[model samples]
Target: MTDDQYVAFGLSPTSGKPEMLNSDIVVAYYDKDDGSFHAVDYSVTARSQCDGTYGMCPDERVNGRNDASVIGGERRNGVTSITFSRPYETNDQLDMPISRYSDPITVIAAIGHLNTRKEANYHDDFVTKSNVVLDFTSSEGNSCSTLVGGGQETPRYLPWPANIIPRGTTNFTATIGPTGGERGYSALTRLADSPSWGLAWWINDLLIPEIYVERGQTYYFTVYGGNDHLNSARYHPLYITSSPEGGFRQKTVDEQNREQVFAGVSYSKMGMPEPTAVGDMCEWRHTAMDAWEDSLTFEEYKDTLYKKCDGDLAGSLVWTVETETPDLVYYQCYSHRNFGWKIHVVDSGRKERQEGNNRGSTLLPTPLLASLLLATTRLLR
Candidate 1:
């Protein structure tokens, strides 16, 4: 047997108690060519909430489980997962260990790009990823390996990335890492409901990726929600509109007929970046959405929204809205109410609309414009 292999000594065959600990653990993928699981050139992370009672102490010590990381290091994309191999009972215990475990309680739970800096940005698509592995050691020289290989010493728990939603400010910047100097914030995932910032807002909530993010990636902010809900469900209608003759208007091809976007509010509209002092940048993040869940195809849900507009009608002004299932995220579209007729994200709003010589302005009601479309197109016919 391999040195890292697990040998169940006296474990009960039918014991649901598990031969190993239970925590966030993933089995690294091996190429089998050179006996290494090196595939993706990214880092992995595992997170478990602190279970201890309130009131942290100046000398409080804790630790993680070993069944956590069977094998953690470099790997492409992990296929075989070592689950429940980690344990999480220490955090809730009354007495903190005098010799706290090293690292987090969770095994390596996720893998992608390895970056110890910044905060997690959920803007990137993270469908293809791997989990983290926990590294542990036995109390003495004796060691037991389970499905998650084996190590020495006790297991340590890892913390989840902190989620940051920038509001009331134009930008959020800071330092992120074990060294403790967060400098950026990655807009990880969207909330079920829009996060209101009072006067300011996140453009279209059309985050940078909506996928796996790093520790801190200071995302640039612009614009306000005004009356529009940029952070809405994917099923909701959106506008890729522009302002004709300049500002916000309902015209794709403007008077000049240039293929460009309309500019939004002047520079004054943008809020100065949030102060870098303190931990303004997303140094930590808490991911609420599940990584694995059954979902509909992007095309399937898009068809439903198309039927609502009945776009093909000749005399009617038409716009396209693209979206995904669950309707909480993944949405895009175009609106006749825009000047350059660009693909405007509702959440990002005017901030993303800043393009071309055209400026952003209010559009006439859709009903009024629809009437004009019918009249003008019919007359031309």
Candidate 2:
């Protein structure tokens, strides 16, 4: 059935509840005569006020479902473009394969429309849909050629073309995954931590990437908590925090134990030292020596002053970039406020080393050093 099919209906099937009202439309289908790219999921129900008219009820049929293949669309003017075909390898084990070219496959979307049909309910609206990355090695043409397909309405952010981590930011690695939504809606995935959800921080390993830094340069982040889709029961507990405001929505459970109010500071009243209670989950500091105060201990401040890693913050924890840090620094995830990472701190190597020492002190002073500095300023006047 195809009437411009791009249905991403009300998702939450694993108990974030709210199923079938609409939300979760992430379709990235690209198959330029077999270069391949297909990852689809759908289900959409609507009726906010049909008897009155706010979003204007029904032309209804959005009920597509479960993994890869055979969907097509076209709605024109009001916009709705869709086309589908799947198989770069698919037995549909929740599908994910468009092989070769490695990194660039992240495309998460959300949509649950209904402004009024007498409003029976349908809008937990996961911040209104938008995520794009369907590049199958673009030599400039045909990667789904100009791509605007699928009942068109998937845009809330789309601007992926900036890596920025260059200026001495070391081999950083932040990879965590699985967020079709239902977790906290994303810092990577958070609903706090509900049944161990997911969250992310992917730079260098790519996937959900973002982490650019400079300001006095000394950054290091490893945090790869396992992901190849699910990494065998993925041992969650991950951590990293900073926020001048780029991420933070914990909502409660003491905002997921406050985690020192998300790095603004207040670690249990600053006497620093408290994580050794191994039976209720809070003791995994790899080492930051007594974990840098502020009353330390939620496992010594999320394992050594907010670097927290059990599966992969990656060897020796490694983190330095902090001269007071905060150009936007949110590598978050206490219990999950959407998981974590906004990290953008630029001074650009202290403004290109103060513009090369002010262009080497205003040049032109070399005529024998300006005649010995004007004969030592007239013998020091």
Model number with the top lDDT: 2
TM-scores, one per candidate: 0.21, 0.25
Cα lDDT tens digits for candidate 2, 85-139: 5444444332344555755544434333211111112223333234344445456
**lDDT score at residue 14, model 1, on the 0-100 scale:** 20
lDDT tens digits, residues 1-381, model 1?
221211111111122332112221222333334654322111111121111211111112123222323434332232233222323333433212222364422221222211111111111112222333233333556354534434353222221233223222324221111110111111111122111110111122212212111111222322111121222111111221232112111122243244232122212346321111111111111133322112132222222221111122111112222322111222111211111111222321212212222232233445666787799999999
Instruction: Give the lDDT of residue 69 in candidate 2.
Output: 51
Model 1 residue runs over 4 Å out of place are 1-108, 112-120, 123-137, 140-265, 268-296, 299-381
Model 1 alpha-carbon miss at residue 79, Å:
8.7
Query: TM-score of the candidate numbered 2?
Result: 0.25
Scored against the true structure, residue 167 in model 1 reaches a CA lDDT of 22
Predicted model with the maximum TM-score: 2
lDDT of each: 0.22, 0.35
